[model samples]
Target: MTSPRRWTLRTENTGYTVRLSPDGPWAELDAWGPLGVEDGPSALDWSRRTHFITPADAAPAEYLPYGLRPFAGADLVASRPGEERGVWWDFEAVEEAAGSLRLAFADDVIGLRAVLCYSTVPGTDVILRWTELTCTGDRELRLERIDSAGVTVPVSGPARLTYLTGQWSQEFQHTQLDLPRGTFTMGSQQAVPGHAYAPWLAVQDGASEAAYGVALEWSGNWHMTAEAEPGGAVRVRAGRVPHEGAVFLAPGETLTTPRLACAFSPDGLDGLSRVWHRYERHLAGERLRRPRKVLYNSWEATGFDVDAAGQLELAKVAADIGAELFVVDDGWFPGRADDTGGLGDWYPDPAAFPQGFGRFVEEVRALGLDFGLWVEPEAVSPNSRLYAEHPEWVYRIDGRPARLVRNQLLLDLGRTDVQDFVIATLDRLLTEHAVSYLKWDMNRPPTERGRPGADHADHLDLDAQHVAGYLRVLDHLRAAHPHVTVEGCAGGGGRIEHATLARTDVVWPSDNTAPLDRLSIQYGFLHAHAPHVMSSWVTDAPGVFDPRPRSLAFRFVNAMCGVLGIGADLRAWTGEQRAEAARWIARYKDVRDVVHHADVRLLGTPADPTFGVQYDDPAAGRTVVAALSTGRLDGAPLVPGRPERLRLRGLDPRARYHDAESGSTYSGAHLLHYGLPFAWSADHDADLVVLTRQ
Candidate 1:
């Protein structure tokens, strides 16, 4: 038998092929989808050249040896110890394992080795890629521009790119652009990921269907580029951002880049998103088995005026409405009446909680709710006790002043004392109180990221070290207090990545809980993260900045799509409103399991007059669809022209499903082919449809 020219890595129900050209230039991704080839190898060609076009206007004119090639993104970009020319690597070896493949390449002249690694989860289409570079020569290597991995897809007709961009309070706004054969890029060098661009990008075949996507798993500064080559082929490159400084490696030293996950789907962008959800659950391991509590956070209700009596009143109402966890956010800490002070002081305000957290915890527990506290361990207000005692603890350049963001300076996690302080403080809090959950908030990025006692030569990369230190603190807390769950919130959605997700049980996508605006925010968030980890809250009407007065049902239905939380001030609600909220909470509990473990599908975009999400768990034989209608402004009573029917997806066509609400049974074939009629009145209407395999 002849050796296969193309090798296939078969995943769950998808196949990805790596083909080597007969001319022996480079290995290219020939195909990636449900079928290995859409038509034939000739139709989906992979015979493109590996070299760059000479003096191209879009790229460097000098033809940087390791830069933009016609077929694939550069895997490695580095020069010798004292040279400016990038090393030219030739493919050497390929190895295959259980669910992984490793490709090794080498630069003979410079004696540098580069290895490209690819791995996939057992039952998902996501292919993870990363790079390892090492010097085999007898000299040191100065490295710059090292990307984890890159892949290219050939387009047939009109193509478009979909991505997300937003600010602090308005994060994860879904946006798209027509692919007109140019380079599109997003990156962050602010020491942490930015609110403007999420580390994810998708390329769709015009109709916003049949898509391919890539998401970087790094938490530190990172960059992702999607360049549309002239001939309808788009290449994507992503990895850690080399913004701090160039890396130097002595002979025999090796550096590994962060993992970049790529997936393809024939069913559209929603299908592609489902694969990511599955992959994340697989990584979540035991955490997936634990049921997420119906949390009630008191941040919006009692911002800085948190007193024991106020929290107790909220906890009683929260428990009455089925909240299992009650979190006191921000104001509980000493001197923390406002954002400008008391960030580093992690203890309860002496006057507010005269007896400390003991009585408050007992009261919340007495109301059948678990207690939680908010802490900004990585940030310090200059006026606080922690900063006043150790001013050198904050990140700062030798003589320059420490820059403040949100009236706080980022603690130099690189220092042993600072790290110790964070860990010890958290350990004491968890040990002292009946705190079942922690709202870990890092409100700002590192500024003047330089340490005082450390030498510049060795401690120049303080930002990266700070990230590691932050992760270390979480690891320690998890080990020390296994029962405590941490919710990662970096000024609302700023610190999102696979690494951070791995440590925390949940993430706050944004502080803005206005139901109308959140529809779009949640749409973009779920594209890259699992719904179980995305924290969605239902607060009061006429949200913070948005003037839309959404019905309580609309807010509950929207928040139910994720790990549901109630941030509304139940204390002020009428008896009828409280009863209604209780019923919604009960309904959420009925399908919480399915919501947490199911494969989510984005039913329609926020741009559509009707927006919603569908959760389907084939194995569990459960399906839940939550749809919200954008009603017209004219105070019309009835839903304008009737509600649009929702077409069910991910159903077994031959099986039967029974709708609980209508008490009707329908064939899976009919439900999948046709859509179920939704009942609603006026606008801003919301409904939760539940079905079971029967």
Candidate 2:
């Protein structure tokens, strides 16, 4: 019998060769071509290549080079090229287990070292240190620098870093770098035009200045490769400038670069690291159980008019429907019994629940469902208690009141007091209630921008500061809670970044709950992220919000591809509708393990008239195929003729399987090589086929 040698790795660049051995501790890495080669044609000379051009010639200096320098305080000298020009510097690697590699070089003019460590996960994390020394008239000088430039600088300085550490592929490039998950560029910078600098220089009055202003730029990219074994092939290419880092040396100064480190593992330690962060940042680890599947929410059902009895009624229906979680969405907080009042107050509204929130939570738990509460903690209503108490906490314009979004004001998360207040409030809620899940929400953009107690002229940069503060708050939450499953919601899908994903277990794909709408959106999202990270939920009655016939089924099917949950009122569903939901839920329960763990195959592309998603459940020895026809010819038979047989992938050919829908039998070879036939009509645009090995 031939053992499964199903996965293979290759690269486009011939300069590198990767060897995989089952017994080797790591895949072998051999030198590939002299990539980034310039036969006098520099790497920066990509103007002739259409793929390199941007909509504008001067692309924003989003990408930059950042590194660390060692012996920052030392002075070094170099000889001229050809006349013993090269200078040498020696340094020792500290904590090799930290995974950093350092290299140094020196010449007649300058001495330098480059330390680089690529992470094994999806995110940016490259640490660099650079040091240089020069002498003038027998005087020695030392230079040290760390690239902590702000994001506005063309060099990105770390904000634009993409999460791409891990087994990743870029079209023809393959890679298996040992990268830690969630590692991302923390700082970067790019050279601004008309401001380039040349390393050649002289010293005057204690300062050694160089000629030629060079453009320095910095940007971060993400990567995920299919290569897992050692010696896996990968290719990388980057544009170059007129000169890399070159330093001018006086007679006797030495320079050093910062030490670099990175760790990689086949056990997915990087991903686990990010998961640990997500747990801590979102306070999910403290809640020992995974979030429940069937969740009932009051967003559509109650809106802002939620009373104790109203909540209890919904709780009863949720409990009866076997829903595991019930969330009291918007309008629960102080002065918020209606939409007009109470923006920032964290206290519960007395009118809505006369008995208080603790009693309400007890009542809900008594009905056999866990309680979840919604909080737009980042936004404050104009009439909220907190807003009244600390109006200065809201972002406001000079001599102007704060602008409102959805009748809310963006909270100033930059202040330590603000962060501490939010943390304390959340901690109180978690400690006081049986809250298992949190629908953490952000409803507004930063508008008014003023530093508290500062004059109107001292306004802050709202955008950058707010974004950074949001990350800080998320980090604080995760560190503090560590037990609750936090659901990130940015008015829908606005904040879908790798950093956000690293801090939260699930993200709402969008407020557009229609299954058809979600299919493509989810597809686009999955292109860069894992499917399990998405939270796809059912919401509202079909015609009320969505006018599609199979709205329910469509939502269910779309959500089946990700984490499953419901946000609508089950009590409003008829017996038949409830039964259908129950059946679908059971079906999900039957195959969720496989769907979550299996390798996915996109059978058809959107560019094609038809779209399909297929999953091969190796553990269950089953395969499920889902297809949707976007455009169909009129008068086409209800069941189209000669259905295209799909050449399925990611399956074991030796396994025998029987179709769940048709009882058709076939081996993996017959199913994958020959393909499966799917019949459908224009009205019935979507179909699902499941095959289980018998």
Candidate 3:
């Protein structure tokens, strides 16, 4: 009964240890030194008590180990009697065994360092990639790779220095490195510019469950640009530069990058396209915008009691089933919503829109669609009105009063006027309506609160300073609504990160609108995110609580793999289910620019009875396969083969094709050796094979 050894690494002189072998691969490492003994006798006070060791283990009442300082041009150089000399340690165990486990520390002359990686990728959730560094002592360094759910990828060239940070957990989280251009002066003070290392990474199924490792994807402020080559050498480029991936460095050399974290177990999309090609090569030179209105919601369709003409009649049946955005979930907000109460009162509920929310955003933009709203804005409702006009903005413990879940509380996002009233009430509802989209949500689970004198094992550094004040209220709503479009709903797949997808584009993912639970939660959120940021919809077909009707071609083959929403109500379907939901939302708006920019291939197994295909052809030699079937078995009769002759991978394999779903086509070697008849049914369902190349 022991197949779980996935990973482990260890080191010490006051720090370093990692272990994860509960069920795959293998990892175990340990290094140690300083423990106790100090009696004040010269030799630099017995070499600072044999180079430090004061961690007696306690912290973790919900995590708060923010302590370890010395990485900003780290220089101690030599110590023994308990070691501690320039300090160096590194760790990584990610061949996508649910990507995570990256420990690092650096000393020996400044280049900033204090990083952490902790994802446990099961259904693509888990985050923590916090960073605060400042380096440029010249040896090359640049890394802007933020993941674990807050997407920012960009890593420029030349980096080689390794491991810094000297000391251990005092409830960790205090960083300050300025590296004014490097030279050294920690005695007369002035040398405070670059060098601060306290690195970490862990995701070999990160501690397992708790809804998968509590959010983090390179949390907050990541930027390191340096250049001073030719001898004193210092060349670095890190990414997320103006929004695109980047990485470049030079020191002792070691940069393997690509670890967004994933795990579906029932194993499908396994390693999900190498964690979506390391988050699309750290968002390789950005520019891919597409979310003016790609939706499908229904609180799972009619859950909280819908209303407001039953949600404008399900936004005119999701704009006659083609939908271009029409949200409206949670019974139209205000003190006492259907779910219970208007969580954190963002307002709007003159009896569920008796004319207001700008006339329900001009009647869902006069039926052409394009209006969305559903906010949690950090949470409040203890019968709200901003918690009865600020009950010290929530997050308590001092006098106790702060424990209520779902009926709600939370809202003390480490206060800065509660991140300026959640960025001025979501920028006054995107400047009084015409709202383009928001969703947002957060639900709960941060618990109690402590940081006012810390010690309750330091409430996870005040919950990472209220998740860096909810990313400074989403960088002030993307600097005041850069053309709306939010999404990001926690409590439903909880805040998947890369720092909340660099201020969100889309997420929602789970209210479980059954298309077989979104084909196993979007094959585990397209393994680390970005199948047009996955949202998925089409609800209310015998799945209000599992009656099992399914089919609408297995719910548009799992809402055509995402960003398509329609929470059923189109005046109650049935015109052949509204022409098969407007012919699969017009074939997902004609292959959504190759499913929001191509390159994905899975084929089968979420527990294989066989039926799971996903191929995309980005222009040059066109191709697109989707197939499905994890149901039918034993009755037999469902066998339709012809992936033309299937064997395509990244395409252009000598072009020449044509089967935009069967006009008879072949080549790319007869569709990669003729193997594509996917017939495994509970009445015949699931298929999406488009191949073009006249």
Among these predictions, the greatest TM-score belongs to: 1
Tens digit per residue, CA lDDT, model 2, 264-346:
11112222222222222232232324533566777877788778898898788767656677888888876775666675677
- Model 1, runs deviating above 4 Å: 1-6, 20-26, 38-75, 544-546, 633-643, 652-656, 667-674, 682-684
- Per residue, candidate 1 scores C-alpha lDDT tens digits across 204-247 of 86743678888887778888887776656677778786546666
Per-model TM-score versus the true fold: 0.92, 0.63, 0.35
Rank list by lDDT: 1, 3, 2
Predicted structure 3: clash tally: 111
What lDDT would each prediction earn against the true structure? 0.78, 0.48, 0.49
Q: List pairs with backbone clashes in candidate 1.
A: 631-683, 631-684, 638-682, 639-682
Query: Which candidate, 1 or 3, would have the higher TM-score against the true structure?
Result: 1
